[model samples]
Structures are given as structure tokens and as C-alpha cells.
Target: MEITLLQGIIITIVIMIIVVDRHLEALFIFRPIIVCPIVGAILGDLNTGLLAGGIVELAFAGIAGIGGASVPEALLTSVMTVVFAHITGNDVATSLALAYPFGVLMQFTWTIRNTAFTAFNAPAERYAKEGNVKGLMKLCFYGIVITMIITGILTFLSVYAAQAPLKAFVEAMPDWVINGFQVAGGLLPAVGFAMLLRVTLKGKYVPYLLAGFLFATFIQIDNVLPVAIMGVAFALMEYYRSGEKEPVTIKGGEESGI
Candidate 1:
């Protein structure tokens, strides 16, 4: 599906909002899983958007930012991957594999944005010295605006210009390599889960984790929601069981004093 000018403008607006607006949980809205579908809807292909979103979301799920560090540029990558997949008639995996370079490119943009913001420090300090609270607020607001403009422009160009080049690249790829990407795409989510487990797994949760693995692997439960429901049930049972009062023991078989 080709992105029209109006659609491009809408998407640019959406990307800007997702990238810059965080006061109202913008991060949640813009996560690959959510943003991909919005992009797909813009391009008139919801299924491809949803598929690409879910795949990319899982693949990068464990890689969140730590302190001042950066995580994978999931927002932009998800948008581009879904756009590429929709336009090229390619599988979600192929689009995912192809989207990595853009993520790296976004990293550079992120660093540049941070560095650019430092230029505001002197002006901010001057405003503070003069007790111009409004000036400081305006400075911060403009900084955000500039950042959003930059993000919107990049997102527009990436989605609008990527269509032709991605099509050519996919067309020229060998069958074996394409198949390899598909397999890799299928397996990459597991790596994300492993990364997540590295940070989150504990001895107490291991049994529940093992049970989930058994349910999925042995029972062939491919859908995740059912496993999640089972986990919730287990947690509730544990909560109630932990709250139960221990049986009181009578001393010397004598009547307890009231």
C-alpha cells in the first residue's frame, strides 16, 4: 500500500506524538506492538501492521533503556518494518531483519538530539539567574518542539522514501537468504524472552516459569493469553494460600482461658 501525502502527514503527526509526548503514557501507545498497527491502519493494512508490530515488539521486549543509555529504536523500526512489509508484500520477518539498520541510524539521531539540547543549558542558567521562570519553560518547550519536528521529518522520509529501495532489495535477495530471515524472525522472540528472564527470573518464580514452558511445549499451547490466565490463577491461589491462618494448637488438652 502506498502512503499518500495526507496519510504521510497523519503518520508524521502520530510519530511525533509518540516520540515526544510522554507525559500521558505516550511510551505505551508508541511501543512497537501498538504503533505498528496504527501505521498499518494508516497504510490501509491492519493485519500486516499487527503482525509486524507483534514480531518486532517481542524481538526487542527485553532491551529497555538503563539510566542514560538507549534501547533499540523500536518506535521507528516498527513503523518502517510494517510499512516495508506492506509495500513489498514480504513476510514480517524479512521486514524485521531489514529494519535493524534504521534502528542504528535512530541511535545516532538520539545522541544528536541529546547533544543539541545541551546548547540550551546556558540560556536556561541565565533565565534562572534572572528569575525568569517563564523563559525557562519556553526554552524547554521549544526544545521539545524542535525534537518533535526532527523526529517527524525523519519518520516521514523513512516511510515515504523506503518503499522503492526496500522493494528492490527484497526482489534481489536469494531464496535461501529470505528463508533464513523467516526462520530467524520466528526464533528471535525467544531471545527477547531470554533477555527478559536474565533480569526478571527468580527462584520463587522458576516453578511457574517451568509450568508455562511445559504448557506451551508439551501441550502445544501456542496462544499466549491462556498461559497468562493460568499464571494469574496460580498467583491468586498463592496469595490466598499465604494469607490463610495456621491451625491453632491446644496446650495440655486443657480448655483455653477466655
Candidate 2:
């Protein structure tokens, strides 16, 4: 089945049909796992979306936010990569490059949504002051709904719009441009690492960080199985050392310590 360009765009738009996670109290259309495949399947390129998504997922698998700081925006990156890949004939690496910038840009979108929610916070505060459960309910629902709906619509629209310019841009550029982008792609992990370092670069953990990175970069132990093994080994060793206990023994009414 041939996928018309407009149909591709519409498929991207369907990403806006978001389902809320009642447990988390946050809004998103779908998990990246779900979203990426859908994008690819719609574009008649599910394999491409899955592959690119797998790369993107692994790259940021360790990312998380602590103490109200920012985290790498995976959702935006995933969406952009899928849309851009579809537009650019689904080049995996190129989709990565296109998605990377959007992640950075989406950080600002994060700020905006957070800032808008701040206003809603004030109303919630007022409700608390007045003991208005209904007010709180209204504020929470409105905040979550409005933010998510706006986010979905905007993501769908921007990604849909971005397709044309991205296609045109790729088509117009010389091969050298893509080559340069590829060279940059080799360096892209540094950005994720730098963001990671902001949190993980403790004096005590520096050696572990260096060792893990070296193993990943030099020894090529980055695949899931090897990394998992290393992680389990590290955890076990740490536990053994930390769980050391004094030995106690008693023989024939005499107590002895080894």
C-alpha cells in the first residue's frame, strides 16, 4: 500500500489522540515505544521508526530528573525523528540528527508548559485557601487537559509542517552537508553525557563513570547484554562490600573472633 504524503502527515497528526495515565497524573499521547512504531507503521516504514527509536531509546535510557531540574526531552525527540525520517526517506542517522535539535528545542516547550502550569498552581493555591474542592478539581483537570491537548496539537502541527521544509532542505543540500552532519552525529552522545555529568559527576563516582564510559566506547560493551552484565556485577560487588559484617564464633564455651 502506497502512503500518500498527506496520509503520512495525517498519520503524524493522529499521534494527538492522547490517552491519559490516571496513575501518573501526566499527559502524553503514547509511550515512545508505542508512538514510534505507529509513526513508522503509518508511513509504511514501521521498521525505520522502530530502529531509529531503538537507537534514541538506548542513547537516553539512563536519563532522569532529580530535584526539579531538567531532563532530556525524549518525547519530542522521538516524535521529531519519526516525522523527519518519514520526510527524508527514513534515513535512520539523519532522523537522529533532525530529532536531536528538536529535543533541545523541546526543552523550551517544557519550560513553557511548566510555566503555564505555574499559573494553574496559583488557582489551586486560591482554592486551598478557600477550601474549594471543586475549584481544585477544576484547576487540576483544566491544567492537565489544556496542557496536554495543546501539546498534542502543537506537536502534530509542527511535525507535520516540518516535514516539507525538512524534505526540501535535505533534497537541496549537497552530500557534504549530510557528511558533516554525520560527523556531528558521532559527537552527539557527548551532549547526553554532558547532561548526565551535571548530575552524576560526583567525586566518589568519577572512577566508575570513567570506567563505564571507557568500556562502552573502547571495549564496545554497549550492547544490552554486556551492559546488563556489567551493571549486575557492579551492583553485586557494591552490595558485598557494603554488607560486610563482623564474624562471630563460639567453641566449647569460649568465644572466638576471626
**Best-performing candidate as measured by lDDT:** 1
Candidate 2, pairs of clashing residues:
none
lDDT of 1 at 148: 83
Estimate the Cα RMSD of every predicted model relative to the unseen true structure. 8.1, 8.0
Model 2 lDDT per residue over 1-258, tens place: 234657645664464453234113266334456667777777777897797677666555455444545765666677777777667664666667767777767667767777767777777888999999999888767765765676666566557655666678777878888777666655665666666676556555666666676778777553657756776888798789768873563433222211
Native-referenced Cα lDDT, model 2: 0.64
lDDT by residue for model 1 (41-93), tens = 88888999899988999988986665657655777888888877877777898
Score every model by TM-score.
0.84, 0.75
